[model samples]
Target: MKYFRANRPLTINEVQKFAPAAFADKASLDVSKNYSFLSTRNLIETLEKKNIVPFAVAQTKSRTDEAKESGRHLIRFRHENHKLEIGEVVPEIVLETSHDAKSSFKFSLGLFRLICENGLVAPCSILDTIRIKHVKADDSDVIDAAFEVLDSSDSAIENILEMKRKVLSIDDRFSFANEATTLRWEKESDCPHLPLEKILAPRRRKESELDLWTTFNVVQENLVRGGLSFYKLNDKGYPIARQSTRAVNSIAKNLELNRNLWTLANKFLNN
Candidate 1:
């Protein structure tokens, strides 16, 4: 059975302590007889700790008109820093009532943001409200709808880049801005040849079915031709940055490099 993402699974320790016995004992008070009594209290305490307490009691749900008027809604999860993490992927709230009007369906809904980009920093840039929803029946259908919602929200990605800029600035690094995106001095220093401006430019279209392997080969070819060392050395490292950094640098190294990736990227973009 599929469990809700909002509700994570119980830990091993939790399961071991609260597990019930198969049969009841005859002589003394059966520990298994009151299994629900022991488990229910523990479950409630665990949920409270995680801030995932049920929204309403069993058979008691609120059905308000405000829940019906839906478009985009933010679902916030309390984080470690006394902060609430709003999912960058936005979700819509829907309320469905039963024919008898005795039951209601309410869930925070949105698409998962599955961004594939050349840079770790760029993909991690997303920050805002994130919504968690379970696929009631058709998982693939729900995923498709989520992608559609992610494709629609340009502001969400913009906000992520903006947050990244502020973080860089606080570290006393000089930041170079191009419209909505920024690059820090440290990132620029290591790869001074990179054209910082164009790389961070938000894509004209959000979703692309580009094969990353093909893109990597294209980038490797470009790097080989451009004379930039594909391998960089760290304190105790050998090419720790991996392909993502290689691709980002390959595109940002020169205008001609970007053109090459774009020229190759078009092959996948078209399909």
Candidate 2:
């Protein structure tokens, strides 16, 4: 999965267990000679001192052991000391980086929705992130990016309130779930075999409400966490065999899907 979540701050051993490349001492091969290695471990340690803790971490999977050591990683953080008592949904900052030269050190806003117990990656920059090349970046830069994110409690609450206030009709909810299927399974896949009612089903009592936020969360959890059932088609377009979907495993795809879902949720905002 994209995240190895923890109830408490993780130790170096725990981090490496899930994302060893976070401790990589050098950059991946084929990069410019000037490309410097930036240790995600060091950055986490620095942020820890500032009361920001790494609660979740993950690295890309590899077919070969050698490639595994240089995989990209993403670590999600929260402030332990100055944490906001935001009831069900708390904010988090997610930072993605790599030694493979595939991506830069990207920082973005995330949310810890305790109601469903899932962490959401907010598409907008609630806390502004830096965009410079990783080679010239320092530990202080991440700290600054984090500080900006933690400073925006108002916007976070406002966004959540907007979703909660908007109620959805049955067709609207179905449309939301349908678009989500395209987002998750891609437009070309046989995702239509998956029923909208299955995606719309609530996992808990609170989620049974017809609010947009609840429906969005319902579709998101079902899509990302998998578990729903479907079937592949035969050459004649008939049912072939039964199959269950799989949870998102890649850190890169996880972030992309989450961001797209967030953007999808926003379409309701202007309507």
Which whole-number lDDT from 0 to 100 does residue 73 have in model 1? Answer: 16
What is candidate 1's lDDT per residue for 1-271, written digit by digit as tens?
0111222333434322322110111212222332221112333344346443321111112254322221111121111122223323322211111112122112222222223212111121222222223213222333333334335336434433433333222112112222111122234345533333223223334322123322222233333233333345466655554222332322123223322333333333233
Q: For candidate 1, report its TM-score.
A: 0.20
Candidate 1 residues lying further than 4 Å off, grouped into runs, are: 1-188, 207-271
Pairs that clash in candidate 1: 86-128, 86-129, 86-130, 87-129, 87-130, 111-146
TM-score of each: 0.20, 0.90
Poorest lDDT segment (10 consecutive residues) of candidate 2:
124-133
Candidate 2 residues lying further than 4 Å off, grouped into runs, are 64-66, 81-87, 125-130, 190-192
Highest TM-score scorer: 2
lDDT of 2 by residue, 88-191 (tens): 78777788888877777787788887556687888663444444366777666756766676667568678889999999999899999988989998856556
lDDT score, candidate 1, position 40: 24
| Clash count, candidate 1 | 6
